[model samples]
Target: MDRIILHCDLNAFYASVECLYRPDVAHLPVAVGGDEQMRHGIVLAKNEKAKAFGIATGEPLWKAREKCPGLVILPPHSRRYLHFSQLARNIYQRYTNRIEPFGIDEAWLDITEKGMDMAAGRHVADDIRGAVQRELGVTVSVGVSFNKVFAKLGSDFKKPNGTTVIARPDVSRLVWPLPGERLLFVGRSAKNVLHKVGLFTIRDIAHASPRVLKGCLGKAGENLWRYANGLDDSPVAMVDETDPIKGLGNSITTARNLTRQEEIRFVFAHLAQSVSKRLRKQGLVGSTLQIYVRFSDLSHLEHQGQLPAPTQLEDDLTREAWRLFQGVRVQKPIRALGIRLTQLQSVEEAAQLSLLWNEKKRQQTAQLEQCLDQIHRRFGPESVRKAPGLDENLVSLVRSTGVASLPGRPHAF
Candidate 1:
């Protein structure tokens, strides 16, 4: 039997969640964006009304404003969005455990294990969509198909509160006419490559010669051909079946370019704190520390170093990031800084204290950061920062732009 898959995508997630809590702007052309004065300014999400005015996600906030002068811009609330994402997932849990999250706002579910036929699957899709709308006050677009890739594309075929079912017999009629760019992983560069080779539509990719595709586009060429032909067989993994997280990192674009060590250290400390908090939450530690620096000229530098041991402590990350920053050779002022913790392993798998290092001091620092995490959870993220004499303006700019929220970027679901 063909697998039954459904892709659930929350519509305008951030903007919709904002409207649910703030009824005053629910009717207006609202968007969730960063503050322009802080250099984090960009449209994160927009309502349907905003979409009508050509405002799009990740566009410059000023451009969006110009398109619709009355566009109401709201600050992002990450915690709230996280809360709703979980709530929406709870609704999906009622149907199947074979749920694979694509991002914070999108997930793929396999209902094939339930032994449901196409008719039954569509009913389940409708019920799931209706339940989310009724309970969460947010609408979802559901795509019902027999495979994950097609299921995702089906969800995108409709919007806000619609369901699109691409059944076995309907693929040729419903999907082939769409451009090849509509398929997942076919970005701008891939599209240009496909078009250059005369694969302009999904139908073109479906009928293209495999020998020619492999030679021209490499593995991606064959992958797209298979996807276009509905040959995808990837499974929707259960929550626990998902792959272990590779890393935890956070970055921010400063309000002004930073060149001095003091300014860089202040930013690195905050970034390290953010990464550490997330690592603790996941009960993981990283042995490799990396930092990315983007200069004002848009050029970037990234550096990585091996740590003595795996750690989820902020001090370890901060020290390693600072050391890496010191080694970076860039003449330009840095407009942004990013810290990444890779080479992850379970906290239980961490190495024992080194004979060369002080064990008591390491334990003490870990305990302190854990306590601060608890305090931040209760009071707020801004409640207790470990870095002293940190520039308040810099701190606030990073804080307002939460770790999960990046300007001019779309959620890569």
Candidate 2:
């Protein structure tokens, strides 16, 4: 039996969610982004109207304005987006258990086990799109196909609220004519390389020799060849069998450059607490802490330190992250700071605490953070914060700059 897969992508997720809440700007060209005063002003997401004006995601907010002056900007509410993402997944649950999330706003569902054919898959896609629109006040573009690659391509073919299906034998006719960049994982650099070699279209990739593609781009080039040829057989990971998260991280672009240890400490406190909360929630601990610093000029640096033992305590994370930060020699003012914990192990897998660090204090801090987590879960994230995080200036910077990625947990809106 042939596989039936469907990829669903939320349309302008951030902008759409903003519109749902702010009806006044619902019809205008809207964007969801960071505060420019913080030097973090970038268009994270743009509405269809904004897209029509040639304003793309990741463009600086000032440039987006230059492109379209009337663009309505809304501050992102991370919590709300998380809520809606989960709600959308709940909707997907109605159709099949073989659902795999691509990101917060996209997922792939395999309905083949349900004994469905392409026609049935199309019906399921339409049903899901309608349900999402009616219930969540957002639309989804779905791609239905025999493989993951083509299904993802189909989803991107249409926009906002539409569905496209590509059958097994129809791939050459439907997908080949498109640009090579449209193929999954084909970024600008790869496209440029392919272009230099006269492989300008998907059809070019489909017809190219695997040896030449591999010789030029190595594994990546070879993988793209297979994807372009409709040979993707990667399975939709079962929810229960999904891989464990390798890291927990959070980064923010400060309103102003941080040059003082005190200023850096203030920011690290918030980031450490945030990362620790997620680690505790996931019942994991990390033995390595990494700090990423991006300068005002856009250049970046990273430093990593080993912990005496696996820990999820905010105090441990804050101390180690601060230590790592102190070790780095900054030649420029730092514009952003990131805290990441890798080399993760389940809390249950952790060994006894080493004598290098105070065991009693570790236990106490762990308990304290656990209690705070409960309070935050019951009330709101802002209900409890570390004492050092009380600086209003630092608080505003952290809030305005916004989070880079919230791995397992949905960040607070």
Candidate 3:
């Protein structure tokens, strides 16, 4: 039996969410962005209206404005985006646990265990697409297929709100005519090599001999060939599954350039707490702490230090992160900051506290943060805030955007 998979993608995710909340930008060309004066002014995401004006994400806001004079740019809201991402995930859970997130706005669902066929997969996709629109006031495009790669391509086949299906028999008719570069994992260098190999379309690559592709592009070529011919068999990971990863991290591009140590501390407190929350949620702890600093001019440096012990406490992570920050004698005023923890171990096998640090204090901090976690889980994430996070602008900036990638957890909306 063939596997049934669907790739669901939220349409204009960041901008769409903003529109639902901010009535002021209704029917206007909108884009989410950072402070232009702070050198973080690129368009992070744009709505369909803005896209029609040739406004591209990651391009400077000034350039985008030139394309559309009436472009209404708004500051990014990180916490809100995370909230909506969670809401969408909640809806997806009703169908299957075999949901694998690609990013904030895209995920792949495997419903083979439900005994779904290609037709039923499309039905499921349409159901999800409708649920997201009616329930969340946001639209989604779904691509139904037998594998991840083709499903992803199918999602991109249409926009805003769409559903496209590419079954095994339809591969040549629906997918083969596209450019070879459009295939998953095919980047610039790979495209050039494929062109040199006289493979310009998915059909060209699909029909090419494995030896020819391997001789040209190595393992990547082989992978591309497999994807083109519908040979991709990667599983859609369970939503709640935690694979043993190298590390976990969170970072933020501040709303404004941080000039003083107090400003830096404010952001660090929020980040450490956020990272610790995720670590504890996954029942893991880290033995090494790393600090990342991006300066006003975008030049940056990173440094890592050993923790007193593997810890999932906010205070401990904050202490080590601050220590690492102090050790780096940077002359430039910072534009953004990040914290990461590595050399992790499951809480069950975590080692004893290092003698250099007070064991009683460590235990106390751990206990305190754990209580806060329960409070957060019960009330809401923002129910509690550190006193140091009182700086109004800094607090707003921290809440605006969080570049976080952590273990997935199961939860209800």
Best by lDDT: 2
TM-score of model 3 relative to the true fold?
A: 0.67
Give per-residue CA lDDT, model 2, range 197-274, as digits (tens).
Answer: 999999999899999999889998899999999899999867556677778899888878888788888888888888
Give stretches of model 1 more than 4 Å off. 113-115, 192-198, 208-222, 239-244, 258-266, 277-283, 287-335, 352-413
Candidate 2: residue 172 lDDT (0-100): 78
Give per-residue CA lDDT, model 1, range 161-244, as digits (tens).
889999989999999999999998887777998889888999999999977888878998888889999999987889667576
TM-score of 1: 0.77
Per-candidate Cα lDDT values, in order, are 0.84, 0.86, 0.84
TM-score of 2: 0.77
In what order do the candidates fall by lDDT, top score first? 2, 3, 1
lDDT by residue (tens digit), candidate 3, 1-413: 98988899999999999999997885999999877765568898999999999998877788999999999988888788889998999999999999998778889999886566888988888999999999999899999999999999999988989999999899989999999988977876779888887899999999999989999988877988899999999999998899676687887777777888878887888888888889988988888887888887656777899986678888888888888888888788787788888888887777444332566877787788899999989998778766766557767766645554433332100
TM-score, per-candidate, Cα-based: 0.77, 0.77, 0.67
Q: Which residues of candidate 2, in runs, are more than 4 Å off? A: 113-115, 188-200, 207-218, 239-243, 258-270, 280-283, 287-334, 352-413
Looking at model 1, residue 173 earns an lDDT score of 95
